[model samples]
Target chain A: MNSSANSTMPIANRTVFFVSDGTGITAETFGHSVLTQFDMKFKQVRLPFIDTLDKAHEAVRKINEAFEKEGARPIVFSTLVKTDLAKVIFASKGMHMDLIQTFVSPLEQELGVKSTHTIGRSHNVADTEEYKNRIEAINFSLAHDDGQSDKNLSTADVILVGVSRSGKTPTSLYLAMQYGIKAANYPLIPEDFERGKLPSCLPAYKHKLFGLSILPERLSEIRNERRPGSKYASLENCRYEVNEAEALMRKEGIRWLSSTAKSIEEISTTILQEIKADVRIY
Target chain B: MNSSANSTMPIANRTVFFVSDGTGITAETFGHSVLTQFDMKFKQVRLPFIDTLDKAHEAVRKINEAFEKEGARPIVFSTLVKTDLAKVIFASKGMHMDLIQTFVSPLEQELGVKSTHTIGRSHNVADTEEYKNRIEAINFSLAHDDGQSDKNLSTADVILVGVSRSGKTPTSLYLAMQYGIKAANYPLIPEDFERGKLPSCLPAYKHKLFGLSILPERLSEIRNERRPGSKYASLENCRYEVNEAEALMRKEGIRWLSSTAKSIEEISTTILQEIKADVRIY
Candidate 1:
């Protein structure tokens, strides 16, 4: 039955290009994400660092080649900052979706000013202090990962407490990298459950703490992959840990959420929103 | 001088909305990145989880309100999958940039097939193995950070070596998070400089190694922020460490790049391109 169903499905045979004046990361990210909404698959080509007029012309030629070979107008998603360069690509046979120009003019008129019209300044290292803060946040998170250090608990903006395999590490790193937040995560262990309280180091910083709980089945599956056929991977153990952790969080009046159904982006965004952190820098 | 210059600069007064049926992270990221190319700022609003027609109408109402108040057509970047929902926003006074529809039609014609027209599948947790791989990569990178663990030396896809504060940790973490590459970073300390060779554990995995170097002045500045008025933070010391680290990398025939001026994204992209890693999953 599965083979028959698969045979009836149509195959994808289109080409797509992400053209940019800089790293092309933004074009590719936005383009791929939008493409995923459709069932069609694409052969994606990235043309990065197209800063010069000559490079832009070369990109147009390549795009035209794809158009001719495929007998279809290939799609082009571009973030080109220069108007002249964007015009060159816009003239190509492909259908152009200019990300920057489509919005920049309206923004300029609304602000009653002109744009900088610069290339590669969006994610560049133009500001030193922002870069320093990102690095410092990364370092702080690393030092305090898995309850490794106790020196700077007071300095942390948010201390994530959760059971093992409950996804505290990735969420912490994402918070730091994306929003420059100083986040530290500590794993709640069986000892903490026996003690019937939070960790000793967390009492002074209870207001800054956030909790993550996972479904018992999902937690058991994740733990089983790490250490197979162990008591730590047992379903009964996972259920007990999750229950105790939730109870402790509710007793402490701390905010908590389930990591079982959410992605890292969702988890981090929810934490930032719940904690009322300033997320404008992102 | 700074206060006088700041007073002359105009503040931005435009409102921008990122409307989507999912997390809206892609719309926000692409919109904000493109907006940064211009000098004008915006009051940004994100309306996510808009999966129904009623919710879509609410978004259109909100967008039109912004337009009426500002007396300008606000910019709307949307990734809504449903045509009816997207059309509702398109009819608003705001300038609507339908990210998915702008390209999906060309792609459909090119492929001679119809799209699945699914919602919320781009970054969803529909597949278990992909999530497991991401978590495993994060765990591996964390365990091997700063040469802390030698147990998984053979399992790493890339090992980053550099002097302290050359951005090995953040780059490693970014690679793991974005591309699911198993990355480990080792700090090249003074003891390694005294011996004048690569670390003992790195000799067997020479082909899998990448090096990060930074400007001496920048390195000194970064170190000084951590430990002020120490020999380790001296410019002369920083120069010695960076020079020796570069020499060691060259002698070992390893690829290296300076992280002084590049963003973490740029550095990671360069390494991925040079190493020929399969980064298409991103």
Candidate 2:
């Protein structure tokens, strides 16, 4: 239950940020950044959609319920939501939890503009004329690279191979977009796990082989989010699986990178560097 | 090419950032974040390898060259590669740039604890046991959703259909990771243009379709990055292609999203909310 935070306090005292516009990640990104910068200990909950006025009011009720259940105070960080809805939700629930609406006040002050009822984070870039195509290219490359059932691995400028749950995809996409490398990634799935060997497609390109290993407990927690009660998410199995995977990687002499806690930017760049691949120019 | 910063500046005056330690992305992440936050533009370059002492020395020489050429005072935010090599490099260079070594400074100042000489940014989240695995799952899902070959459109929780260079991949990854939704993307390649219809795979899943359109000049610039001198990357071609693609999408009654200046997070979430698909729990 994330006992890392004090659970006994009232909702108002403890900051509980339930960040979301109509979309969750946008709100979460800003909320996480601000939270990290301030070193504030807060419980973060993402409730993605609250687009309508009714849904916004409903969210307040849900927040109050969660606070009452936890016996703690809460603070909220909401982003890019409609002002009216945000006002209603914050006003109705402010007595219980302090709500920080991230985008509105500053945005309004800066541009003398309230959003034209738009629903997401504003794109602040140097070149709007060029950003669109870059975004589209990113989309094209992403759609083209799904590692499952794709046989054209040869076309990839770089290929990432890791056991299931190792950091490969984000690394690949980041490389593709940031540096314009045609990166492809394939998972070392359960079948490979059963064989106790790297997948067949890997060894031929072992020179480019990179592995991502993580600690078992972290794996368990992340897996728990996906499948809460299954043996697949069990800590014991995770430990065994991780140990076995690392051993196989070492025996195969496939150079590996540990992804435990490393962000996408770190993992991707590290893999590219270890492989000594050409510097991607975008 | 980027002749902005100069050398002969004091240690603190020069802002230098080295993006290496094998993972250029990690280095870039730290550099970009710090640089952006400070709004201090300086001479910046990425030296991707400093794994050995010799390589470290070579890196110093390259830095000297950049300093000499730019003539603008420099500052550095370097990723001091491996443990042994970092010590050697630091001793040789004697702390030149603004020199914010992410790993070293934090350990020394924050905990009054010194590191036992480790390489890379794994320490940022090094203690997380399952860090590698969670990253792997994200990468795997990212690979699977690439718009090109994941032809089983039926399984897509959301499918982004757009002209070439539309913001599809980032949007897909954002949806999958932030929302846990399996988003698939399909590009409107040139063949689709010649055929005068949407790709056959798209019509079957039209109900889940969302389109992304970009400003033509932005398309031109992105294409120029890929094929610098080609007519395909020409402004005229971009204009023609964009107009034709939009017409096709409009004719088909597919609700399209304009990706002119939207960040990937914004684009992805906006589409997810617009489609009202079931948000994935992760």
Q: What value does the lDDT take at residue B98 in candidate 2?
A: 21
Off by over 4 Å in 2: A1-27, A30-74, A78-92, A95-123, A126-170, A174-282, B1-38, B41-147, B190-196, B229-231, B277-282
Candidate 1 regions off by >4 Å?
Answer: A1-11, A57-74, A88-95, A109-112, A126-128, A278-282, B1-9, B53-74, B87-95, B126-129, B278-282
- Residue-pair clashes per candidate: 0, 53
Please name the candidate that would achieve the greatest TM-score relative to the true structure: 1
* A1-282 per-residue lDDT for model 1 (tens digits): 000012223334456788888767777767767666554445677787789999999999998998889887877888988999999999999977777887677756655668778886555652446565776788888888889887889999999999998989999997887667899998888898899888899989999999999999999998998899899999999999999999888989989999998878678767876777622422
Each candidate's chain A: what TM-score?
0.92, 0.50
Best by lDDT: 1
Q: Write the per-residue lDDT of candidate 1 for residues B1-282, one digit (tens) a residue.
A: 000012233445557788888767777767766666555446677777788989989988998898889888877888878888888878988877766877677766655667667775555652435555666787899889899998978999899999988999899998887667899999999899889888899999999999999999999998998899889999999999999999888888989999888888778777877777622322
Which has the greatest DockQ?
1
Per-residue accuracy of model 2 over B1-282 as CA lDDT, tens digit each: 111112332222343545355444334433333332222234345676567777777876765655576553333345553556666555533233222243234423432334334344332332333334334434544544435465455766777877666667676765654444667777886788889998876788888888899999988887898799799899998898898889988999988978876666557657766776422211
Q: After superposition, how far is residue A173 of candidate 2 from its true place, in Å?
A: 3.4
